[model samples]
Target: MASPQPLNGATPKPKPITPSEISAEFSHHDPTIARINNGSFGCCPSTIIAAQQNHQLYFLEQPDNFYFNILKPSILKTRQIIKTLINADHVEEISIVDNATTAAAIVLQHTTWSFFSTLFQPGDAAIMLHYAYGAVKKSVQAYITRAGGHVIEVHLPFPLKSNSEIIVEFRKALQMGKANGRKIRLAVIDHITSMPSVIIPVKELVQMCRDEGVGRIFIDAAHAIGNVNIDVKDIGADFYTSNLHKWFFCPPSAAFLYCKMSDELSDLHHPVVSHEYGNGLAMESAWIGTRDYSPQLVVPEAMEFVSRFEGGIEGIMRRNHKKVVEMADMLAEAWGTELGTPPDMCSSMAMVGMPACLGIKSDADALKLRTHLRVCFGVEVPIYYRAPVEGEIDPITGYARISHQVYNTVEDYYRFREAVNKLVKDGVNCTLLPLCEGYAQLLQMLLKSSLPVLCISYCSAVDV
Candidate 1:
């Protein structure tokens, strides 16, 4: 076979989207502004929007017939698309959920933590990173504490040098957990860290979890799906959940949970709604109540849309990651900050550490930076405080994570830098501005209204 050529007909370039093109795309959706915080909730393509609308229309056209005859078949079609995209053997092992958080919570709810109560006896250890999503950390901790299990929090090094360095540090943390005589029952690992965008070596970490005789390995891959080429089977995790709404361009309520097939762990229960009392398929866990499953059904269209524009999943991954690297370089130069992770360790997102202002302590400072960038300049990105923690301190001090997707442009980051510099030069007290008025209100409303559109638009833009 001849070697495949580039999909875009040339080497993929990391150029910003032109303002005219942005206007044209937003014109289709009737939105007056471009959204830069796609990492928070991705924008769907127009195709997925049409698919969703078609499904809803069908339901309204014949409510009972659509629910009874059409819905299951549509979902099965969606499963086939998901299976091909993720390279799964059986489509039955995948179940759609609202988001990654709900998927993880459902898995947690079904597990019999008491089975490992003796192994993870009181003071027996569980380990999690400081950078893990606060909600996920809290969920895991709650489960362990109820079973009288101890929690050993590990602080991952900020501004990591390479992928291997992160793997080594994670291994060391596991060793520490074992040495403390708390047989690790479960470890919550992130395929991509929420704030830093660090792509951890999940395969190696899962194998290590198995070696430690851990009962389960739960992955919170909130930012993984469309941002990377994910083969859940290759990762060898016991349980995995990821947000299609965030990365895969599916509409809101589009996400999936995967459980490795085994007779020992076959039957699982839904988190809240339990229509299926006893079933082995993954869908049995989340498809309990009567609600619109249209978002989940539209996933195939979203995937197809992405493949049509960017060639295929691999092509899209390469382009998105390249854009993230390019944006990080441009921002670092413009802001005098440094990139935290090397190219290999980074995915389609990057974190740049900013200098802290005098007397600006805690996360409030981070909020100020976020506000200044969004209200003053229209750039939306996440700003977070990296406090001093054991084994990681200095360079990790103050940082903001910038995420890049297909819809983002280089000009967005440049505008963000200009706004922050202006605020610093003026010695402006960001908080002094009336918290209740003007640009702030506009920003708040824009973000609120954009959520559904963003979710729908992601699938439409990407097609898968």
Candidate 2:
């Protein structure tokens, strides 16, 4: 298979999306030409995109003065905007990074693990959920194992009955760790798990960590920032990080790492080779050498753009959340499956577990869902299988995670339901193989249409 062409060069002519054509309840302003499977990366409003372009132009005009005098101050201002958006008391504690993964890695690398070593020793404990992002889980495993630390895996059941059930089960796991007489060095909690799209009770869990006398709390809020209201101080965790790109409509590589103020927790480092190794804030972590600082600088504009819409940020949250729940209910009814999480635990996204009769054994089945929906129906969502290491795997059970952003409409969900009904009624073995082959052609078409304009112009295939 050939690689898809890039969309960067010879920028497409600007197309204006008017306010009246947009949904009154949501804030997104873009033409729905392609189905969006990648809301995890986020889509910026035209206003924010314009602001980013302006900044890029400015930097191109003069690079040096912008780096020293302008860039740092601009970023600090961006932090102030974040502070107001998230209701933080002070912006000093917040440091911007590329994304949540980078933020989590920095917190793990910089913190004093010796304190944890004294408590956990060589074989003692750390705890995490099964649905934690694969990257974060690997980072923690690498850090702990190198330091002779043990990690306890906590299995979170799908189709949980309630938030209390999740909390109680997690608490019981922590108690089990305590019973083993292994000091709990850290608890990595997800503000929202990616696959299931369930919001964990971070405030309750962090307090539990404190009561358990754990060393620290690290939160992965990759999907949390724009989907729900977040106040890091209220969360009461030692460390937290979230990607603004996922939910906040900020450009890619925009995220924040927040650390609680403490004289003892002063040592932190940037991930790459940099001059500010010793200096705490400006020199060490902040510089990180030269790259595009436009994304970080334009964060405030993204915040402002969201604010201008009818529902504002909170309004967008409520609107998208309601839409996804409705969509989930409809899809569940169509597929004869149950919702994965309760309404409260569900946010702007939800997961529907595939019924026992639908055989989704391998990656082929997963790609079938991705391809069939995109080509046949123009709908895009993710489907995959997950099981606890100790739990029984149902050969036929899998899940399709549906994400509803502002651009998504009720018609999109209806189309998805119809497609699934057709596929499930037909035998999986007979239906899936042809679907996958057809999907290859669909991908080719999308790639051709998505080819960068520069390539099209140079080739002059038909019309330039």
Query: Could you estimate the TM-score for every candidate?
Result: 0.83, 0.83
lDDT of 2 by residue, 238-293 (tens): 77788887778777878887777776346666777587666664235457887787
Per-model lDDT: 0.69, 0.71
Which 10-residue window in model 1 sums to the lowest lDDT? 455-464
Q: Candidate 2: where is the Cα deviation over 4 Å?
A: 1-39, 111-120, 281-283, 362-364, 388-396, 430-464
TM-score of 2: 0.83
Candidate no. 1 TM-score: 0.83
